[model samples]
Each structure stands twice: as C-alpha cells, then as structure tokens.
Target: MALGFEELDFQQTPMGELFLRRRVEPTLGADVYEVKLGDEYLMSSLFTEAEEQLAHLGLAPLDGSDLAVLVGGLGLGYTAVAALSHDAVGAMTVVDALPAVIDWHERGLLPVSAQLTGDPRTRLVLDDFFALMRRDPEARYDAILLDVDHSPRHSLDPSHADLYTPDGLRRLARHLREGGVFALWSDDPPDDDFMADLGTVFASTRAHVVEFANPLTGGTSTNTVYVAHSAG
Candidate 1:
C-alpha cells in the first residue's frame, strides 16, 4: 500500500488536545487521521480495536457495585467512552499529560470523545497518571487501564519509559485496591524479562491480544493487554 500524508490542524479538549488531518486519503486507507496530544502521536481510528478491547477488559467482569476506573492515555477517548457505557461503572477518571487533548473532547473535536466528556460519571484529570498514582488518592479505583505511549518498549516520550519499569510498575500497582485489576495496553508483546518481572509483582498475571490490520502498511498488527491482579 502506498502511504499518503496530509497535515492536520489541532483543536483543544478539556482533557487534552487533538490534531486531525483535514484530508483523509483512501490510499492511506483509513478514515481517521493521526491524533496527537501535544508532542505525542497518541492514536487514530486505525487501532481502535486495541483501545476498545482494553476498555472491555476492565468492564467485562464488573459485579455491579460502585466501580471506579482510572484510564491512562485518553487518546481518542475510546477507552474512556467505552468505560462510561457500562452501567456497572460508577466513576471513570481519565488522565492525560496534555491538556489540549482533553480540550479537544470538551470542544467536540472528536464527537465520540465529547460524548464521554459530557458523561456525568467522567472526570478528566490534567496530570500525569503516574503522579496521580504516587499521590494520596481521593478514593481507590477498582480498575486501572494504562495505554500510555505505544507499549512498554516504545514511548512517545522517553521519560514515559519509566512507567513500564519495575519500580514504576510497582508504584502503579500500589494504587489498586485488594482484588482490583490493573490492565495495561502494549503496542507489542512484552519480552520474557518484562513478563517475569510482572509475575513477581502481582499475585496472578494474564495477557491477551487484540489483533488489527494496518492498511497503510498492509500488515497485520497485534497489541497486547496485560492484566495483573492484586488478589487472585
């Protein structure tokens, strides 16, 4: 497939800002253009399968009580939107480093994101999720969905690499309540070393794949989601 490119203008949302390419190319083979949050190439409609699946992992087993969720990386807000769709979810807190990305949702740059932003259960936080995890929590969340950068390996920002490291993972893990689940979305499968480290941190660990086709590259892509439980 021949790759095509076009410049996209950006708009602000309450959570972060979104940049969209005005002229979408069929040759590029997708309806949605690149979505960037500040300097981060967050995501596009292309990989929505992975985003939606990440949300499903959190919402699928809800027991119908007050379930609060923290979503890292608002991206196009698919994960946040999907989380709010579940009746079992009482509160959904979305955190992103870029305020412009959030603003895009607030200003209706992305209609789907706007719907989620408008939801009463949604709270958009304009801070790094890692910072929030380290701070005293106003309340403990039932689930934490992390999809920052591409994966534990590739980061939109080099500093974000700490988020996947053992120390960082440990800090993020501490935020969860007993029996709470921490699910992370990776652009690629984690290596043996990474998996081994996760095993030591969580009582039980499991990983699932979300497959997608990248029309631009004409190659099949698979994203992984790692679900770690504090209490098994």
Candidate 2:
C-alpha cells in the first residue's frame, strides 16, 4: 500500500489558520488524522486514549437515569463520542469556539463524524465556551467536560486563561445543576494551586493522571484530568 497524505480542509479563523489532514502511517500501520493550527499540531487520531479516559473518569461518579452533558471542545469528536457512549447520557451538547472544527465534522472530514453526528443524543453548537459559562443559560447540565486549552496556566489563546481563574470557575459551576460534575483535561500534570481554587468553588476536587504509551517516543507521558463536583 502507498502512504497517503491529504489535506481534508483549511480555514482562516480568528485564532489562526486551521487545517485538517489525514495521513496513512506506514510505520505505525494506521491511518492518522490530525488538526493543525498554523504549524502547531492541535490533535491527532493516533493518540486518543487520554481523551476518552477524560470522559469516562469524569462521568463515572454521576448516577442518574437521564443525564445532560456539556462538552467544552469537540476535537476530532473523541470526547463527545465518549460522552454519548454512556447509556445514561440522555442528551449531550458539544460546544467549540472554532467553527472550522465543527465544520470538519459536519463535512464528514473527521473519522468519527458519522457516529458522533448520527447519534440522536448529540448536538453540536459553535460558541465561545468560556463566554457561555459566564452567563446563565435556560438549562443546567449534569456534567461538564472541558478540553478547550492545553492547561490552566498554559493556553493556546491567551483569552482562554480566564476560564481557570477562581471567578471563572464559579461561573462554570453556576451553570451546572446541584451536585453536578466539572472535569478538565490537561496535557500537563496536576497543579496544586488550581486544585486549591477548585476547592473554593466545588465540594470535592481531584486530579486523575492518565498514562499511555507514546508510539514515537516508545515511552509514556501522562495527561491529567481535573474533576470538581458541585457543592450543592
């Protein structure tokens, strides 16, 4: 078989140039899909273990018959797909700041697009997640999964920095129903100061480290999933 490299789509957004590429990796013997902003790699289908784990660990504590979930980002549709996997999840709204990301899925350029969009429980919304959190919505959710930025301190766009602050976290908590759960995915290890701030806004807070094999490095790196349960 021949190694295939194709640029699926490209767009110029407020953030930067976003492009979706699908390549057949011969070394790994897999077809890899990736999203790039300028020259920086945003996400890839090659390594999605941590992304799926983020949803699993976050939704584990919720024991409800019909659950409503809000996912902050829809990178490659991994998180939204994982959230919809739960039988208890009656409805899920995935919101992303970048319209191009959402467009990729609707255009069927992404691998998981069909499964994610076909599911009746899923809804894709293009909006600024942080701004939406600051204001009160008509409804509250049972779980909120956030994977918009790299980490609390390090952000892809400087504007997202405010979401991790104490006041910003409180805004997020207000949008959740009583006893709701808030989860965040970070490429770095858990931060003590951030967790301390979570304690102020939430009743219970903890960080989960997800370790997976790195194909290129032949070693393991960890991703942290920070979880905070509502005080009510």
Q: Which stretches of candidate 2 lie over 4 Å from their true place?
A: none
Q: By TM-score, who's the top model here? A: 2
Q: Residue 87 in model 2: shift from native, Å?
A: 0.3
Q: Which candidate is the best by lDDT?
A: 2
Q: What is candidate 2's lDDT per residue for 1-232, written digit by digit as tens?
A: 2269988888998888999888887768888998898767888887888899879988998987689999999989898999888999999999999988888889887778999999999899989998898788767999999987888988888778887999999888888998899999998899999999999999999999999988878798789999899866
Error of 2 at 229 (Å): 0.8
Predicted candidate 1: what Cα RMSD to the true structure? 4.1
Q: Give the TM-score of candidate 1.
A: 0.84
